[model samples]
Target chain A: MFRIIKKSLKIGVVTGQYQKGEPAAVPVVPEVKKKAGLFKRSFAIREVDTGSCNACEMEMNALMNPVYDAEQFGIHIAASPRHADALIVTGPVTVNMERALKDAHKQTPDPKLVIALGDCAIHCGMFKGCYAVTGPVERHIPVDVRIPGCPPRPADILEALSELRNGRP
Target chain B: MPEARLCDDVLKVAFPAIRQNAPVCAKSSHFVVPKDLLPAITHYLHTQPNFRGRLTLLWACDHRPVRDTYGLYYLFTLEGSHHWVMLSTELIGNDRLFPSITPHIHAAHWYEREIRDMFGLIPQGHPDLRRLVRHEHWPKGMHPLRKDFPWDRVLGRQQGEHHFRHIEGEGVFIVPVGPIHAGIIESGHFRFSVAGEPIMQLELRHFWKHRGVEKLFEQQTLIDALPLAERVSGDTTVGHGLAYCQAVETLLHLEVPRRATYLRTLFLELERLSNHLGDIGAMCNDTAYALAHAHCGRMKERIMQLNDRLTGSRFLRGAIRVGGVTRDIDNGRLTEIVEELNRIQLDFSEVGAIIFANASLTDRLETTGILHERTAWDHAVMGVVGRASGMDCDLRRDRPFAAYDALPVNVALYRYGDVRARLRVRGDEIHESIRLIRELRGKIPDGPIANEPSRSPDPGDWTLSAVEGWRGEILYMVMAGEGGRIHRCKVRDPSFVNWPAIQWAVLGNIIPDFPLINKSFNLSYAGNDL
Candidate 1:
């Protein structure tokens, strides 16, 4: 038990300092702005993976790690859709998950931003024209932001969410 | 010599009506049994001790344009050898009445059900021929795999409720969980029959994520199919991608360079390391031990970041191609990777000690979700689940493809078949994978990363390649089509065989421990659903 406390204190303050607007430390940000508005408030997101390879989901999980520490940025993946301010949907949206995707969108309270998290969510990605796929997530629900990549990195996801918090949408 | 004798004996003794015998690969053979003798052949192979016929794959293809009949293929492997015996038969002109082998081979139950749903081929006397992949609402008789059903045809979502079997008793209440889960995981429904806490029965319904992976493979050239194979299961990108590439390389008779083989092995071990670490953490978290879980997640991210640094993708996507790997790990980078992995191992050991040291954590893990040794063998479970249950099978060791043939792997085994045993297996494998990466780093020879195929794969040529993915045995069967394209590609992820084992494991366990036990097995929903 002594080792736990020692290790905890040894690696002190692992959370990122996002308040200083140090975007360069994180890799590859497509947008930069020295603005402060809705960034002051906490944001809750509910993740809905309609149909993905799960790679994007892995990155999303990484946001909870000590290095990323999404909680420091006032972003938490809430358990219920009613608590969420945004919905992060992944995959090309399979036929089986179309109804659930729509319901998740409908359940999220008003002023909810829908972000398409992967390439598949953006435009069906690699699963185009397959019988099981029901096309892109946008076809089922309106998406405010589209993060494109087979899977966007955790840092990129954080940057996008932070940008959302900044009231850029 | 004994392997060949076993294959020949099975054919000559049981399948005297065999019309043609062809070599599928160096270690595998294809036998075209007469349609009338298929049931006998399938039954005999499963019953015979010499054959030890473990049904690995079963699927059918519509040969209407050419042969005017549907061709059904069943591949099986013996207990010890790497040799595979493929039995195939033709059903004349949609007369899809083939005798079901499930009455004898319990493992072939899902495969037959899938065949009935996808190809509209009736497995005669299949006890429960319920729709497997099509779910509850897919229009009856509309088989998606047949040539008549266009790949892009959208059968707009049909509305219906899935019929789940419920126990009718006074105290037996049914608890239904998820086609959409609360956690950040894939969709799968579980119905548990609980009689005051202890689960009397559990039935799982998955395949909600089946996005026509096989159909997508049919649409791409072999060169472009690697990315789709990687996405078959997000976590097992290297395993599935390497298996697909190896199958293609075998069909084209192309020999990958030594350096490429070593690099592929490196990437595969890295993938394995990341997943095993993450699983260990998940299993701990399910038990409410958040400290170890968080640390392990951070370590996994370290490896994932390293992956991005090396191959531009966190999940090792696009790292492998048809002939070989896409990137090379130079001497400088290789040394650096070994050093970083060693440091990670040291940190992992520190965190692992805390996980195992806590008696409270170990108490919940021991004797929880126990899958018996006999049940594991009967179901033919693969990877860590099989290993934990004392089913001694690792494709990397048995069938030695890529660098595994040159570099021996120490297979982790246990007998308890409990949550702890599975956790112990994963823990041991993480160290084993790290050792393999370090050893391969030292011995990696300098050479070309890939070899250009001399010609396109010949039509009608078919081959099977098996890789021991982080989960279990991943098998790929690729057959060449007209104009040097892929005709049919069947992927059997390790989850395909292990998912059934979960049903057996979950019995008698309380409702609350279900998540912990399920995380212990940690079957891939995407891989299994696909």
Candidate 2:
């Protein structure tokens, strides 16, 4: 127990603050902020992996790490869709996961924003023409934001979430 | 004596039915065996004291438009030999049936079921011929891997219900979990049959993320399919990418530069180090040791950032190409990597000491989930899981690839076969990986990063490549088609073999300990589903 406390103290605070007007930062718009009424102060996201290669999920998990510490920005990954303000969906939406994705989206309350989290979710990425895929997330449900990368880095995901909180779409 | 020749002599005497010998690629020898003789040959090779062969891969290919046969290939790696033996059998003339080897060899169970789902082939005398890859909604009579089925064809869904094995007892109840999980992980379902607290039985329903990755490879050119291979499992980009590239190089007889070989080894070690650290942390988090999780996560982040600095991608994607690596590491960057790894090594050792010293964490991990050696062997489990259960198999040491042939690797083995055993194996392997990277950085030769293929591979020419990924052994069997297109590319992630072992591991353990056991294995759903 003493060792644990010592290690914790030695590590200190490693979290970094997001800089203003960073390259990953989205431009804040007034109209977007007006629409994000309940999500203005804090954002609770529920990440739904439709059929990702798992890199996007790794980055998402990294968001909770000590370095990223997404909780510091008032962002938390909710345990369920009902408690979530937005749904961050990844992957190309395979046929088997189509119903589950739609169900999760419907479970989230009204005024909920859906963010397509990766290149696969945005445009199906490299898995564009595969038989089992049902295309990008937009094909099934409405998408409010799209973060593009084969898998966007954790900082990129954090920036996107900050934009969502600040009412920047 | 050459290992292949020794294997050939033994096989020739044991089974005279072995037909013409096909061309050998790398350390692998190919032979065409009669369909009837395949089961006996495999059974003999597996049980023989001198030649204890492990079934590495079993995949079927639809060979229409050129030949009127559906080919089934069985690849085996022998004990104490670096040689690989692949036996090919043909199901010809309107008969889609092949004698099942699952009854005799338990490891072939999932492979036989997968062959049935992908192709319309029927394995005669197989006990359970249920759908392995295809979900219930997939239309009946639709085998997506057939030559008739187009890569982008759309199909209508049909109503079908998956029957879960029910155990009827006084206090038994079934707990069915997700195709969509609560956590930010890949999607797969698990059904746990429980009585009070202890789990009676566990059935895993995976393949919810099957994206027809192999069929997609058919539509891509040889060079264009590297990204698909990289994405087979996101965490195992280097493993899958290196396997695919090595297979292609062997088929085309391309010579990789010595520097690129060492670089591939370096990048692979880095990938292994990052994943092992993350998994060690995840296991701790599952055990409610958040402090270890935090420090390990920080160390993993540093490794990932180093990967980004050396290569463009964080997961070491795009680092491997057909003949060699995509980029070269300069001397200064190499020095930086050595220094960073040294710092991480020190930090990891400190964290490791603290975590192991904590009675609460070690008690939770000690005997929570135990997989016996017999069960692991029956399932042909590979990588850390296999090593934990006393299966003496490490593809890097057993069958050397890249710079592994020159550089020695100390395989980490443990006999406990519990969660603690798996944890210890990963921890040991992390240190070993760091050592390998430091040694590789010093000895890396100076040359071009990649080499052009000498010529195009002829149609139907194929080869198998195996790499020891962070998870385990990742195998890729690439067959070339007309004009340098991929005819059939069969990918076997270690998860495909190791996933079933989890069910056996969680037998007597409590339901709440399932996640800790599952996290220890850390099998890839996408890789398995694909």
Candidate 3:
């Protein structure tokens, strides 16, 4: 127990301050509105992987790590869509997961936003003509934001979320 | 090539039938056998005393336009031998029925089911013929891999039912998990039958991320297919990309430069180090040890950042091209890698000591989720899971590729097949990978990084490339078509073989401990589904 405490103390505060009005690290599709703050301060997100290669999920998980420390901005990954204020969907929306993605979107209560998290989610990217894929995430449900990268880095993901939280482009 | 002669001698002595008639097509290590002799030959090789052959790959290809037949190939790696023997047979003339080898070889269960789903080929007298890849929503009698099925065509959904094995008892009940999970991970479903708190049976329903990857490979040029291979499983970008490139190189008869070979080895080890660190942290997180998780996560991030600095991608994508590598590391970057690895090794040892000292964490890992050696061998588990269960197989040491033939590799083995055993195997491998990278930095040669192919491969040319990815052996079998197009590309990720082992590992463990066991194996959903 002492060793644990000592290690924690030695690590100190590694979290970085959330910078606002900075240049976007990753390009976001259709630009964020300057004054429509759907999630004011605290943001609860439920990540849904419709069909990804899982690189996007890896970057998303990095947000919770000590360096990015997304929880410091009152952003947490909710266990269920019902408890979530936004749904972060990844992948190209394979046929097998189309129903589940819709169900999760429906399950999330009113005034919720859907953010597509990767190039695959935005336009099906490399998996464009795949027969098993239904299309990009927007083909099934409405998407409010799109984070574009093969997989956007964690810093890019945190920046987009902060932009959404602060209602700043 | 000498190993092929050895395989020929061994097979002729054991089975006189092959000696009586010449093989239909005898290449370096590939043989064409009569369709009826496939099951017998595979069974003999798998169980023979002096030649304990492990079934490495089983895949079927649609050869409709070229030949009115479906081709089935069985790949096996003999114990203590550097060569792999491939036996293929043809199901000709509207006869889609082939003999089932799964009755004798348990590892062929999933492969045969996948063949049936993709080609509509019936495995004669197989026990279970249930759907493996195609879910209930897929329409009946529609096989996507056949030449007649268009690549971009979408079929309407149909009503279908998947039958789960039902268990009935007084206190027994079923718990159905998700195609959509809570955490930021890939999609897969798990069904656990629990009696009180302990699990009696666990059934996994995967393939929720299948994107017709193999079908998409057809009609694509060899260069264009490399990106698809890199995306087969995002985390294993380097492994799958190297295997695909190696297969293409072998088909084109191109020799990679010595510097590129060493660089490939260096990148593969870095990929391995990053994944092992992440998995170690995830295993600890599952056990509620946040301190270890944080430290390991930080170490993993550093390695990933280093990968981005050296090669332009965090996952090492586009680093490997056909016949060679795309980027070269300078001396200064090599020194940086050595220094960074030294710092990581020191930090890792300290974290390892802390993890060992924590009794509560160690208690949860010890003796929990034990997979018997017999079960492991029967299922033909690969990689860390197989090593943890005492299956002495590491493709890097046994069948060397890249720069592994010159550099020595120490395979980590643990007799006990528990969560702790898996953890220890990953830890040892992390150290080994760091050592390999440091050695590579010292001895890396100066030369061109890539070799360009002069001409296109012949229409019927085909070859196999196997790389021991961080997870396990990733196998790619590539066949060339007219105008240098890829006729068929069969990808077998290590997760395809290791996923089944998880069900056996979770038996008798409590339902809550399932996450710990699953994390230790860390199988890929997209890789397996594809």
Candidate 4:
């Protein structure tokens, strides 16, 4: 709707529901490289909201928007925990949400990567050190990365997912 | 504060409109009126008050047969600063059919609907008392809030696509939008009956996202209640948390230090400023006003930056406490806030000028969602939504608490009761908020931020606290337990009453504008879902 940018002969741009795009970043697989094993291109992500303000939900949805199109990065939010190679958890794991969080963490396939999205999940941020809350996600499930924001923008969420998918620091 | 004097010449002159109870001016936290007369009390409130007697607040209720007595708890904030009263009436849980005040107060119609869904208490005389915040698949006998209702009852009930019925008529088509859609706000369905571009009627079916927040809050201790409050609606985090903390504080009769109070007010306004900017942008975006909406988005991000600077978090998280606020302000921070508020006001003025002055924007918004002035008063609407439509109620100006008493609260009013007026009021409020922030900084007392009150709230003490937040008045009713845990906790977000009004407001508007109209009110899904 915004016509701010000058028109261009657009390349093959993707549009539609639940379609996967080319992977933006592929894993290095350093150890596999030493053994001469090829790195996998596809990534499976599991999304869980331990407890959130739902703003994180906003950014999560944003990732799938026409602009960012998280699927364009070959990262998909998987339904079953068993299929996920990485966990994208939001909110400050509250006492009530701990069991489910740990359960999901356990269910994820081995060689799992954890990305704690938003400040609430990383440091418990504003909700830190509360009686009802059990964590900043690290207290229950080990986190590979912490994306800070009351909620990070969609780009930030995508960045976290892509980083974890590639097994990057 | 006297029963005899409460009925002076002015009270006597306005007395007749309906049933009258000499308000038991009880020295308790918050205010109340008896429950049996809930219908009559709201009706009487409509007629008697001298000031804007339109707005009313309905909190949570305890609808259980305890010793053969069921109590319905609520708080009232009369339009204009006339009265703030709390009411509780005992009823037999099944005899819970209290007469609906909706027929009298248009707003009570929806509030009654929600209470029925959650508590299984019918609102007698309610025209359409169907569920407002629950799924259609939700069980008939399962009242989620009832202490006895187990958590499993809502598990499978939460999943599945909702069923919506269409009306068979010539040129009439039903557009069922959501239960689960693309965007990530929270799930709810809006079924619109449209003839061409114009909407014939709209029925909102929600509760897909109801996570049993209220049930969890009841089990939570006062210290542990913050997480639930934070998740009610992410956008208005600080605003609602402060309201909850104030309620618990009042129940214990604790005094928040002035410094703590000022900081709470500061954070509240900052949250308000950011939300309004974002909302104004979204409203423009809804109407295809891309330039104006994007400009506002830029301003909003700046406000978020200001939030990150002043408090370590952008959404102003965990800034409130029961006795006082959590964070402290430093000298350099005070200087930064003054500059940030000034810069925000400057950018805000430009967006306000462009939107209010533009013809295209007004053509889309003005009179599109016309919530009648009388209808607004009948619902006892609060905050900017009520104020814009001439339903004069703002808790800070009327019912003073925190730093609102020390500074000025310049309420913006518009008579048009249209989307444009709502837009105008929001811009005016931003200016006023900027002024309020300036004033608070100037007069802020330099001292230790908090004092831990000596006493905790006693068991069986039924106290309610209500504050005017960005959307409207948020009321919290607390019934303390033996230890630190809460026996019953009710958080009444204004959207519980206002969302249904949208059903009426959207009756005649075109289908395209419903989202825009709803955005102006901007009621929280999670707030009501709780």
Candidate 5:
């Protein structure tokens, strides 16, 4: 027990301070509104991987790590879609996952925002016209925000979330 | 090109009649055998005392307009001799049927099913001919890998449900798990049969996330397919990319410079390091040891950041190209890597010691999920799972590709075949990976990084490349078509073999230990589903 405490102390402020100061790596997210005042409270998000290579998932998971900690901003990865205020969908929607993606979106309460979180999610990226890929995430359900990259970095993800917290763009 | 001695011996033993007719080694090592002789040759080679060649790959290509029949290739790696023998046969006419090797080689079950689903080839005696990749909703008589099929065409889903095999008994109740999970993981379904606490049977339904990767590869040019290969499995970008490049290099006969080979080795080890740390942490997390998980997560993130510093992408995508790696690391960057690694090793070992000292954590991992040696061999498991089970095979040591031939790798092996053993293997491998990186630091050769191919590869040429990825052996067989196009590319992830064995691994363990056992193997759904 003493060792655990000692170890924690040595690690020393592992969590990030994204809210207090400018983040080190700020990816350019276009179309950020200055003052919409939509998101003033903490948000709970449920991540849905339609059919990713898992690169996006890794980056999203990294956001919860000590350096890029999203939890410090009161953003949490909810266990269930029912508990979430927004749905963050990744990858191009495969045929088998289309129904499930819609189901998760339906399960989340009304007024819940849907953020499509990769190039694949935005426009089916490289997987466009794949036989198994039905369409992009928006084609199946409505999307409020789209973050594009093969996989957006952890900072880019936080920036997008912070943008959403400030206003719906 | 000199013929390997084992290849000559295999020919002499399997086809004695062919020697009297004509010399089989005329068309290089790859021999085109008569369709009827395939089963006999396979059976003889498999049963022969001198030549116990393991069936490595079985795939089919649609040869329309040029030929009426679909051409099938079976590659076997003869053990102890490092000899690869390629045998091709054509399944003539519309009734494309080939004798199944599953009756003798049990591991051929999935490959045959894949061939059936992708190329519309019928395996005559396959026990389970149900859809492997394509689901029940897919239209009948539509094989997507054929050249005639368009890459973008999507037939609307037909009305049907995949009939999962169920256990019916008085007390055996079904516990169906996700196509979607409570966690932020990819989609895969697992049906468990439990009497009360103990699991009676496990039925799996993956391929939910199959985004027509193979078909997409067929659409890309030889060099353009590197990005697609990198995304084959996100965590294994380096492994898959290197394997694809190796095949392309071999096909075009382009030699990668010494400096590039060392750099490739560095990235591969880095990938292995990050993944192993993440998996070890995940395994602990499953047992509710959140502290160890957090520490490990921190370590993993550090490695990923290091990857980003070296290469542009965190996963090391776009770092590797068709001929060699795109990025080059000099001495100054190498010093930074060594210093960071030293710090990480100290931090990681301390965390590992803490986790080990905890009795509850160690007890939970000790004997929870045991996969016996006999069962592992029966399934022909690869990578860490196989090593944990005492199936002593590491492709780096056995096949020795890339700069691996220059240096010896001390493969971490254990006989326990339990969750603890798997964890131990990963821990040991982490240390070994760090050691490997340090050894590669000062010894890197000064030369050109890449060698551009002098000429485009001839049509109808093909080659196979295998890399011992962090998970296991990742194999890519690239076949060229007319006008420098890829005819067919078959990707066989280690998960393709390991996923089936999970059903057996969960036979006696309770439902609670499933996640722990699953994490120990840590099989990639994307790799298998693709």
Candidate 6:
């Protein structure tokens, strides 16, 4: 648990990206002490594969393993919406899978963060503005973080979620 | 004397329905056969000794001249020969009816429904033409491939397919799985009619998220269209790009320099390798065979790292341009790429030997999802999947394209027609791909990475192009009107044809083995859904 948090927080500190949306300009919000992010690292994540080829799924599976060590950080990905605090949605959401994806997002609790994992999720990366997909993640729900890799490496996804916990700069 | 001669005579006997002498100027040997004689033509073609007339491909493209009109294309191939035949028909009137060849080519089942859903064409005698790759509530008559179907319709799509046609008996119960499924997959409804756990009937519903790729092609410029093609199926990104780019090149008659061909060849192989890696792992994962899957995942990761080294993108998008590829490898990168691929292939050999040696994996796979040799011929499925089912066909070897023409593709053959066969064939092909990639690494020609700077194509010209995609032969037919604004574009993925065989394969097997059977083929749901 300490490992994932530290790694994720370190990525945040390094990249200096604290939130999902890439902000061009902002009023200096005070560096509020995030007690919410500090301890008890149990994250309820909801995964929505937006018409992915399923490589993202395999990468997600890696995070569940010992090497990527996501479980150690209390970043628990739940199957149910009621329990989810973070929604992990992959991109290029096909025309066919769009609705259920939206419903799942709406079902998640408030103060929830959306992690747009994989290049397809970030800007519809490879699929890039295709017909079936009219979304990067923002088109459908409030995407709080963008983990960009063709499939973001497991480390990247873990890092994005951790940074979201601390809030964006 | 033989069935080949007899089939030729039958082709003559059938007369106009099977056009024996159409204008061959289209660079295709086969005729535009009618849907009615598909069975007889294919049946006779298969029976001839050494005839090797394999069913090349069965696909649908909404070759629309107007907003609501569309046409279907079914392409055929000779078993070992390079020649091919095509059958086409316009989907007319409100009903949009066409004779289903499922009875003849069993492989036509899923494809027919896909045509039904995507183009709103009805296949007569289709037995069960409920939405194969569409959600029920996708709004009837709004086929995604049709020209007029709006793109914005995907946002608020509903579960319109819940009330499917079913058989209600004293104890028959209908269990409808989600447009939203349990795990990480796109939305599709699978309604199973069962007395107990034994499924009597199964219907796979999809199209909850239909973005109308074919229809929308009319609206984009060629450069923009390449990205849309790449998104056809994430697993087959490079393949789709290759197909589309190849078509554009053909239209422009621009020769891709040797280096570009070599680079494109390398990326194509890499794309195949990565997807195969993911497929094998996912198949095993689905079948409760995690040990082998994990190792494959590791091997896949190595392949991805190689992709990152060669091109900046893991998926290798933007790696391909209209005439040639955008990315080029330096000699050092080439050496490293070959060395890394060789190492990965070696590790894969260890993994392959282990998986093949394991009796449990084979037991579950062999004869588990049997798509009989006869049925394989009937549907004219393409790529590794068809070849495994006793169909000796590969576009690379039979109809040479890219740097593949230089490389003698060792087309892997498997007659088992089951999940194990598909797995075994993929394993064999991976080795072949590795060998090809290594040999072509240093031989790349010296030239510009890409050329012909971008330009628009002329209107009123229609071109038909197909490439040996990773999954199989992908057919793309493009027609543009009003000075290349785009009249219609029809794209076909092999998964559209292969999915129905799953229903047949799962029938006799106990319900528990459905996952293994389904995973063996591992046809892309989204690829077909589009």
User: Candidates' lDDT values, in order?
Assistant: 0.83, 0.88, 0.86, 0.67, 0.83, 0.67
Error of 5 at B28 (Å): 11
**B1-530: candidate 5 lDDT, tens digit per residue:** 24465566558665854332222222225667777777788777666766666677778888776778898877776656656677788777776788887888777888899889888888998888888788778888778888778888876778777787888889889999988887778889999999999999998889888888999988878888898998888989999999999998888888899889989989999999999999998999999998998999999988987887789788888888877778788889998999999999999988988999999999999987888887786677879999999977888888888888887899999998999999999999999989988988868888888888887888777777899999998999898877777878989889888998888888889999999999999999999988
Estimate the lDDT of model 4.
0.67
| Model 3 per-residue lDDT at B523 | 91
Which ten residues in a row are the worst by lDDT in model 6 chain B? B21-30
Tens digits of per-residue lDDT, candidate 2, A88-158, equal 99999998999999999999998788888889999999888788998999999988778888888887777
Residue B289 local lDDT, model 4? 82
**Each prediction's DockQ?**
0.56, 0.73, 0.66, 0.12, 0.63, 0.24
CAPRI tier of model 2: medium
- For residues B1-530, could you state the per-residue lDDT of candidate 6 as single tens digits? 24334545555665556655453224354455655665666665555554455554555655444444455666655454455555565555554777876675665666677778767778888887666555554555566666566545544455564556688898988777766555555545667777876778876665554556666677775556787788777768888888888776766557788888888888989988987876787777777777666667666766765675567666787799887888678778888888888887876776676677767777777777677877666666667778788877787876677888778789899998888888888888899899988788656678777777445666645566777877888777666556545566667777776765566666656567666676667777666766
Q: Write the per-residue lDDT of candidate 4 for residues B135-240, one digit (tens) a residue.
A: 4544456666666675434233333354555677889988877443323344456899888887887888755445566676766777678756866778878877
- After TM-score superposition, the amount by which residue A101's alpha carbon in candidate 4 deviates from its true location, in angstroms, is 18
Q: List the residue pairs that clash in candidate 2.
A: none
Instruction: For candidate 1, write residues A70-93 as lDDT tens digits.
Output: 877777888778888878898998
Model 1 misplaced regions, further than 4 Å: A9-13, A16-40, A167-169, B157-159
Cα deviation in Å at residue B5, candidate 5?
A: 2.8
Off by over 4 Å in 5: A17-40, A167-169, B1-11, B14-31, B37-44, B47-50
Descending-TM-score candidate ranking: 2, 3, 1, 5, 6, 4
Q: In what order do the candidates fall by DockQ, top score first?
A: 2, 3, 5, 1, 6, 4
Considering lDDT, which of the candidate structures 2 and 3 is the better prediction for this target?
Answer: 2
Each candidate: RMSD: 3.2, 1.9, 2.5, 8.0, 3.3, 6.4
Error of 4 at B23 (Å): 8.0
Q: What is the Cα-based TM-score of model 6?
A: 0.81
Clashes of 5: 0
In model 6 chain A, the worst 10-residue window by lDDT is A24-33
DockQ of 2: 0.73
lDDT of 1: 0.83
Give the CAPRI rating of model 4: incorrect
